[model samples]
Target: MDFMGFFTKKSSKDTAKERLQLILIHDRATVSPELLDNIKEEIMSVISKYVEIDKDELEITMTTSDEEEGNSPALVANIPIKKMLKRR
Candidate 1:
């Protein structure tokens, strides 16, 4: 029996892990849900001024990494650009 292939479906644990990661990242960055939303909106507004983007698919999140410079929080944004607007 191919037990490994039989249980290829995603498990609840995977979902929980992803959720927990988001929670921890937000917590570590000291960002509230409302603040995160506001930041995302502002980013969209600024970027939209320069290029056409897929607003519906934009994603913004806070990420932290430990490096030689110490643990630093970084704003991670994934904005899909559809096209660049021509300059006046």
Candidate 2:
């Protein structure tokens, strides 16, 4: 057996990464990452109108799925809140 033959087969991790990259690209483009980002920013602005949040730490992602998955395109965002100071 040749040493290079050992590397011929694709690893599961590599496959998973490739799948994730493709899915993410498709999801973002189909749902529009810029639109999603704008939505998140608007939401943050609205929420800030009421309370405070760490905008820098916020995360927003869009997802798309086939009909067989029984789900529609979705936008998911995460916003982290800074803890308030307590009185001594």
Candidate 3:
């Protein structure tokens, strides 16, 4: 039984969902896609120093949340770590 296979494979549905989310985020924020890529790169560079991560699988996005002040935009990131490297 290859349970890991089931978990590792990315379905078309998942890909589509991610794309849609990115599009919606860009439309709402009025930000260029290039800006998002730059943000992702900068974030990965900083985080990489603390842990071993799967850079290819990193996900960063902007989202809105309901708060006391009103709807607030948030930067969300899902970084998959392969392992944590000890800092010297």
Candidate 4:
């Protein structure tokens, strides 16, 4: 099996589906698209200083965890790090 193909890139349809999913997540959280985009940009800017990441593969979502513990909203970031930079 060609495992490398899996992570190299995402197809246009796949990208669109991911975007739609993100929009749905934002809608559920009652957050505007622009706000989420701004948040994503700020996060990427701060994280970029410490490590190299795959921007294309990055994903941020609003979710709730542990139903027993009150379903409070949470921001989840899935950042694919390409490399970790040494401390300056």
Candidate 5:
């Protein structure tokens, strides 16, 4: 029997907290989930023309950024580039 499993199991409180954070992030961005996916796909299409990319490792999300004055939400993308494409 794995005693650690019992201790490490995710509690309901943890799950609810995670859900609440996601909700808050989405609300602050005022962006629908579908719209976000569309934007990500368009970005990938445009970037692919310039370089090879690891599609499976791509990540895009909206998060808060601290500016000179205050906190501002921004779109963040983590794209893994495989190689540069030679222009012909």
Candidate 6:
């Protein structure tokens, strides 16, 4: 019994590749790539006009992907913002 076949199995790079492919498809469908930055800037500007927010600490991003073709819209986003706390 040769154990070489087990070790010779093709590496499972499919997961990563599929994820990337999905991301690309999502990017193509969504307007995120075109106006995401502008939207962030506008949000910052508008919010700044009313209150003070640390732009450096602010984060805005767009995430989109395909779950199933023609099933529904393919667009999503994961935005996170961290605020700096000053020591008194």
Off-target runs (Cα >4 Å) in candidate 5 are 1-22
lDDT at residue 2 of model 1 (Cα atoms): 86
Report how far residue 31 has shifted in candidate 4, in Å: 1.1
By TM-score, is 3 or 6 better?
A: 3
lDDT of each: 0.87, 0.70, 0.85, 0.83, 0.87, 0.57
Q: After superposition, how far is residue 76 of candidate 3 from its true place, in Å?
A: 0.7
lDDT of 4 by residue, 1-88 (tens): 2878767788899889877866676677798868878999999999999999999999887765557867656788999999999988
lDDT (10s digit) by residue, model 5, range 1-88: 2878657868899879867866788798898999899999999999999999999999888777789998777888999999999996
- Whichever of 1 and 2 has more lDDT, that candidate is 1
Off by over 4 Å in 3: 1-21
The digit string of per-residue lDDT tens for model 6 on 1-88 reads 2778546645469657756766665566575555767877778776655555767767654444335554443334323334433533
- Candidate 3 lands at a TM-score of 0.70
- After TM-score superposition, the amount by which residue 63's alpha carbon in candidate 5 deviates from its true location, in angstroms, is 0.2
Question: Using TM-score as the measure, what is the rank order of every candidate, best first?
Answer: 1, 5, 3, 4, 2, 6
- For model 1, what is the error of residue 25's alpha carbon versus the real structure, in angstroms, after optimal superposition? 1.6
Q: Which of 3 and 6 is ahead in lDDT? A: 3
User: What TM-score does each of the candidates earn?
Assistant: 0.76, 0.53, 0.70, 0.65, 0.72, 0.40
Model 5 residue 8 CA deviation in Å: 17
Q: Which stretches of candidate 6 lie over 4 Å from their true place?
A: 1-28, 32-34, 64-88
True lDDT of residue 51, candidate 4? 100
lDDT tens digits, residues 1-88, model 2?
3989657987899779867965776565675656666888789887776556898999776555558867566565677877543443
Off by over 4 Å in 2: 1-29, 64-69, 83-88
Clashing pairs in 3: none
Question: Taking the candidates one at a time, how many backbone clashes does each contain?
Answer: 0, 0, 0, 0, 0, 1
Against the true structure, candidate 5 reaches a TM-score of 0.72
Check candidate 4 and list the clashing pairs.
none
